[model samples]
Target chain A: MSVRLAITALAIGLALVFPFIAPNDYYLSVMALVYVNALAALGLNLTAGYTGQLNLAHGGFVAIGAYTVGLLTVDYGTPFWIAFALSGVVAAGLGFFVGLLSLRLKGHYFAIFTLCVGSVITLLIEKWDSLTHGVVGVIGIPAPPGLGPIRFDTSIGQYYLVLAFLLLGLFVMRRIVDSLVGRTFVAIRNSEDLAEALGIDLMRNKILAFVISTFYAGVSGALYAGYVRFLGPDIAGVSRTFDLLSASVLGGLGTLTGPVVGTIIVAWLTQYLQFLQDYRMVVFGPLLILALILFPRGIVGSLELWAARRKAMAEPRAPQAAPLAGASENA
Target chain B: MVIFFQQVLNGLTVGSVYALVALGLTLVYGILHVPNFSHGALYMIGAYAAFFAVNSLGANYWLAMLAAAAVAAIMGVVSERLVFARLKDAPPMHDMIAAIALLLFFEAAVQAYWGAEFHRLAPPFPQIVRAFSLTAPAQRLLIIAAAFGLMLALHLFLNRTWIGSTIIATAQNRQGAALVGIDPAFVSTLTFAISGAIAGVAAVLFAPINLISPTMGDLVITKAFVIIILGGMGSVGGAILGGLIIGFAESFGAFYISTDYKDIIAFALLILILSLRPQGLFPQGAR
Candidate 1:
């Protein structure tokens, strides 16, 4: 546990030092974007990867958080810290209720319901003109105060702020995976029927995943709103959902570092391929086709498998970790 | 009272489109056993196909619809053969990821061609209906009628036709159906085509009432998912009933419960149903 804690602290310290090393605004900005996206993707990985549920509603939760900040900060002139914390709580609450639904559904049924919640949330954000300002979007979010009254108005300042959040989020997520409840989550994800029979309450554990994931998403959305200073319904659109889903898939679902690495590559590809402009996502079809064709385990899953093999060969493995143990034999 | 009646009628109109969309979802789920997230993208493609038919091909509205259905069916068969066929034996998650990719691809395709803007779309149908009150736009009426008619046709086709029955038989039990001389390959392909055709017809009917856009199908697709879930995974009648129920919910919800949260009605109901009956509203055994 101390080893994990030290490694995480080192990672966060390194992340804080990163933008200083970049020496350029463009690189710094892109790095910041990756950090924020990875944080959100990490949250998604908990639900989609650990629980074997794809909640497309992640984008919506982010939107909820972002808009909360956008509305409170921009419309009503609330400060950044208070607004950000509020957004996180709101997202978590919504997630808990959404998770309550997940208790009954398995696989695609959960995906379907989450997709519905996400879309409806978007539509409401778009149509609730009195509050959200309709499709015109919430704009003019203020920057946070920095060291000695300085503000994170610059891209680099914002970049570091995002990095701090991202690293903290990653550490928290890793801790979750290490905890007893985390074990229960993995168990339930493997087989709800079995997990439930073993006294792991279905409604409580799954909702915890939902709430945690939603909290990450909301915080990310708040970061996005503050950084870009504009928030719209399309941020909760299927395309965004697809991007996050693919990021997790491409990075290797369920791996701690997988989402961070995958998001960096995919996010960069999205921008890099933006030069191709119109046909960018059109190629995404073939890319996904290729990914599925070649690496169905995903890049991370394949890497994990390779790592396991190497570890096995090196040690002759005392006892291998059980596969899908939580949901084990219940199905 | 008239307003209430009007809301009911409107809800039914939109709900039928959802029904049609759910039918596509249910058909593929019955045969292939995966939720087709890309079905929404395909639904959008159907609208775009119709857009191309009328705008570029100079076909009449009616003919353009048929062309759209034909083209959509072709796309479905191509997808089943090209991607889904390969994914048949893969884990269900793999299939879902693949569908999401297709969704991203098709949506991007529409964005590239049409740009991200919405089109008012001059649907071929004329606007006026003879009755002043208690009347729907002719295009909406066509949607409702066509939805019911298509459903009827499907029901009859499945019951009466050899091939349709073969598909249903395969759905019941693939191994047993094969044992009875029904080729699973043929049934799967046929089911995919019919599902695509259903979506195609739905798009044409919906184009006039709603703006036709590349991203148009997603909202309806989510609702379609709810309908399919409420109706039961593979039950055709369930899809129809589920769609209609959602329609009434949305219509009345919009009027009574704030239009901003009308869609929440369907989702709230989805959670309610799942907690009560995880198998769906019209489970196979229940029916």
Candidate 2:
């Protein structure tokens, strides 16, 4: 408990000091984008990582969130805060429909269905030009109207704004992971049959996991729109879905910190390797394949395994004298 | 009436090609249980190969198609042996990610070699054909005939040949097939080769009608996926039916509904059918 608290404190402190530490607007903007992507990846981890659902419509949910904010603010002149909340709500509602689909389909079927849903979402965005402005995209999305004198028009302000949501998102995810609900999610992932045998309602839990994840994706999308000040169909493309998937898997699955760490590494690599823009995916594809084949557990997962292994080696003689070490050894 | 017939003709033509792709997908899914996301890229590669054969080698169209299929078959065998074979026992997600990786790698390779610009194959037989007051391009008929012919040949191969039966047994029960002395690795290699060859043929057929580009695989893959799901995984007849359904939906939806939502119709059908009949319309061993 003390260690977790210290880590949380350190994270908060670093995030608060990050904008000032960044060298320029470019660095700050990159950090903001990383936070945005991390939030979405965290949402994805809830379903794909924890509950054993492969959701290829994450970008679609993100799109729903972004477009909600874009349309509400641009067309109706609504406030950013209200639009943000509405974005999550609308996206959650859509996620419910998607959850219903997940009920029937399993494994690759569910994954493909989500891919189709994602394609349909992008197509709708392109065809519904009146609302989305078609391929022209919604430009000049208004920045958050500052609360009192604290203007968020600057990079530091936007960084802080995005960081606040990311931290809050992390806190919520952590709380969920610590709860019995999270245990049920893990139970479902490890073995649905066994979970069902234990009287867990598969449909309800699956839907809840999906909805919660989509909620996070939606909120992140709203934050993204506010930071970037634009929205487009690319937000819902298959590539974006793959990007989110890569981030989730690259960091570590089924861990709260995994998504954040993974997103940071992935975002950094993609941004810094701008020279490999054309061949980046060419490189990324093989790299991802190698990761899946070699380190299916991902960076954080490998670390966790290594830590566990080290602890086991250190305490082979201690046995059950230390309950925490003993329990993990059994696991 | 003429318009409806024309739409039907168009649907059948498109559906035939869809059937070929779906067959490849279904075969791989049936045996390997890997969704094989790279199948579309292989298809795209086949199209490019045929294009290269005609343009660079000055080969006839027929010879070009055979070359394309042969090239794709070899590539498939290599991929199965080097990458996919190692992933057989891993979690399904691992295979899926690897396949997506392969998809990206293949797409980039095609782009690097062929450039990003779209290429169109000139129709070898450019004459117009008419039947029952419905006129269409000869290329469309060629596509339909070729697709159906390939499918029939595949059906015979699977049902009649000794090796084909061995492939079916492996798909049904891997452990059982292994116990019965069927070499699982050999079956895997052969399955991939055949699947890749089918995709190659579809690509050759598709290239003349549609613009061929690296990114062309994206749309083709999604459509083939829908067909396999609608048809029922591992069901040959189901693939044909599903392809036809998609083809008709796309054609009629474009004409009757908004052209913008044609793709959506196929997806809507997929979701609806999957919800009501998860096993699909023509589940294997049932019909």
Candidate 3:
């Protein structure tokens, strides 16, 4: 626990100083994007990673959140903060609707249903020209409003604002994962039948996880809209959801730190490979396949397994029967 | 009345193609139990292969389709060997992720190679056909005829051939088939090859009617998912019926309702059907 705390502290410390050390405003903006993506991925992790409901519509929720904020601020002239709060509410409402309908589905059915839902969302955004500007996209979204002297017009200011939200999102995620509800989610993930046998309200719990997950995606999208100052139908594209999935899987799906680490790594890798242009995904696709093959548990999950194995090796010898029992239980 | 007939003709043309694509998806899903998202990419690749055959290799339409089927069959086998085969023991999501990765890789590679510009395959049957009050392009009629012909061939192949029976046996019960001395690995490879070939043929047949682009498979794949779900996953007959249902829905919906939301009809139907009957219109194990 201390080691984990130390690592967290060091990481947070680095994040705090990152803006100053970044090469330019571009890097700061990219970092802000990273933070925003991490927030969304964390949301995805709650339902998909811990809850074991592979949501292919997460990007749709993000799009909903972004559009909510974009429309409220740009069209309705609402304040950024109010629009942001409403974004979460609107997205969560849609999430509830989708969850109530689709949560009954198991495995691939749920994933495919959500994939269709995601496409529907994008289609609506694209075709609803009078409302969503169609394919023209929502433009000139204002930066998050500042409180008093904390102006957010500058990239640094915007970066700090996004960072703050990311921290808050992380803290909330930590609390949720450590709570009873979080355990219920993990229980569901492990075995729905077993969890139901234990008297868990499967539908209610699944919906709750999904709603919270979508809420996180919503807020993350609102932040993205504010940070990027542009919103398009492509924001809700299936590719975005895949990006979150990759990050979560690469870092460690069920772990809290996995999303952030994975998003950072992916975002940075994307930035570094910018020169490759269209070839980036060509390279990335195979890389993702190789990563899954090499470390099915993801980098963090594999590391944790390694650490556990090392500790088991160092421990005093136990009875042969005891080791066999432990192995079965773990499996 | 003529307009309705025209729409029916259009729907059947598109529906036949959907059935072809969905049939391939359902077969692979039966054996692998993974929603191979890359199926669409393979379809796109097949279209490009045919395009290349005609444009670069001077192959005729039929020869180009054969080339596409051959190329895509090899790709399907290679992908199964390299990616899906390795992740067989991993979580189901891993299969999905790998498929999605393959999709991204294929799309990007195609874009890089083909420059993302839309290409039109020359229509072999550009003549207009008129029946009673309804007039239709010969290509549309050909698409329906060819798609049904291919489907009929597939049905025979699945039922009459030894390897086809092995594929079915594996789909029905992997362990049971293994117990009966069938190799699951070989079935998987064979299923993938067949699936790829079906997708390839569908693409070649359909691409001439519509422009072919790197992303042409996106909508087709999504609709294919809807069909498989509506028809019941892994059910061959269900896929065909579901494809026709959706194809008709889109065609009729576009004519009667808003064209802007024609695509939404499939998704809307998906939500409604899943909510009412999550098991789909067909029972499981209807293969």
Candidate 4:
């Protein structure tokens, strides 16, 4: 097998074994939450980083995903397994609509338009007061039944479930990134005008990216709903969108680590900084400024640079041209 | 009829505040070509500065207002020097994200210092201004007057002042401005400082009608964004017009439509305009 394949399999292998090695329920919970966030971030990174689209409606899609699972399972008593899959499709549908609808608008228009979607969703959630528990939030949702009596509701069980979702998310993301579609996405990100000139259909690619990205978000939301068994209005908030955007950018947009690194760091930072409460945003202002100044490409992108440096030293005699970096794609 | 007029007047008060905030937002956008998301936070900072200045220093309201603007303007200068200056040549959107990050940091920092519990006026402004049968809150009228006065001053500055005209020249053509002996960096610093100061002044004007809080920036900024879009971005006239239209829509919509749905009106208007007239009511000379 190729070195890349070997690394990939090892990573997957670690995912399967890692839950069993957890230290405690808290750690497991944190890990599970991080994985779910990572999943969502990964999907968002595809659009924001690769397709060069900034989607502020991610949280809304996540809300749709979580709520879809909530309604389907609670109202109809559909099993978690089935509802989970359906929730993704539901989220993807909305994502697809956003992608196709806003495809023509560029930059601020797209961002603002998606923002409208999130705001409208929040409005609907508030207005529809009957279905959702409104501002009070929803509760009493049951845990998914065990895999043959495993009762994944336990801390360890959550780890496994989150692990499963993470694996699936990673696999799907990997496929999306490695496939021809991924190249097309990067091509579009690099230059839509150029890509279109090259005969690539812009609308179709954008719509597909939107759908796939939101599907992951929905799945993440569904998993979160299942875990927490409670949903609130804040799920669809502008701050929620900000959280997702920050995470995507934090881990190095367009790099694989964009999601994983961003999710873990933001989750940990937010959780630990909860005591800071209202003042948290103030500190974040300087940190974000610092992050851009220090590492414009983010943690993962910077890490890749370090690795490349190591590789350069290890192979001094090989006449080398540096591989293409993503700055050209940024504009 | 009084109640109807009251709400409309109330909205106008709020809309006037929005116009100031929108001016700050667009001035930066116009000159630097960077969407400064942190402008809203500057408004919040301005409020807090005034809040502290009044309570701790026992200053006059006007003095407090000037202090708040000065403090926020200083913060803007520091930010321009350290953060935005580095990003002057980066992609325009990168600067936007940086501004957003700065916005988040300030908000979180404020939250950490002061809990999320709402804060009312620190040093009270007079509540009543009886104008014949048209009874207006003294503070509300002040907000309207201050916003308009600032708008006039800003227009004059743009048209009359050497530096301000240079900044406008930069907006018209960065390359040409540089060719014609204008320093783009000086224009950027001026843009950011002016943007922050405008927002700071707006926050001082706003503190009377609205409670002061860190999260207070969010909804106000959304309205500002809407105004910027509607006003054919970068046009001061457009900002004022957009602000008034939204103020009335929100005012009348709240009365006629359900208040719950009122929030959607701006977003809906925004979407409609994008779909129908993407360039907006008064398109900038060359969008």
Clashes per prediction? Answer: 3, 0, 0, 20
Task: Give the per-residue Cα lDDT of candidate 1 at A143.
Answer: 77
List, in the given order, the native-contact fraction of each candidate: 0.74, 0.58, 0.83, 0.59
Q: CAPRI band of model 2?
A: medium
Query: How good is the docking of model 1, by CAPRI class?
Result: medium
User: What is the per-residue lDDT of model 3 for residues B1-287, given as tens digits with 9 covering 90 to 100?
Assistant: 88889899889988999999999999999999999999999899999999999999999999999999998888899999999999998888889989999998999999999988899999998899877767899988888998989888989999999989999999889999999999999999999999999999999999988999998999899999999999989989999999899999999999999999999999999999889987777857432
The stretch of ten residues in a row with the least summed lDDT in candidate 4 chain B is: B278-287
Over A117-228, each residue of candidate 4 has an lDDT whose tens digit, in order, gives 7878887776777887678777766677787877787877887888788877877788889899999999998888899999999889988899989988999999988888
CA error at residue A12 for candidate 1, angstroms: 6.9
Go through the candidates in order and give each one's C-alpha lDDT: 0.81, 0.87, 0.92, 0.80
lDDT at B30 for candidate 4? 81
- Scoring each candidate complex against the real one, what DockQ results? 0.61, 0.66, 0.86, 0.55
Ranking by DockQ: 3, 2, 1, 4
Give the interface RMSD of candidate 3. Answer: 0.8
Q: List candidate 3 stretches off by more than 4 Å.
A: A317-325, A328-330
lDDT for residue B229 in candidate 4, whole number 0-100: 79
Question: By DockQ thresholds, what CAPRI class is model 3?
Answer: high
Off by over 4 Å in 1: A1-23, A147-151, A316-331, B1-9, B120-138, B252-265, B268-279, B285-287
lDDT of 2 by residue, B160-257 (tens): 99999999999889999999999999999999999999999899987888999988888778889999887788788888888998998899988999
Clashing pairs in 3: none
**Model 4's TM-score against the true structure:** 0.92
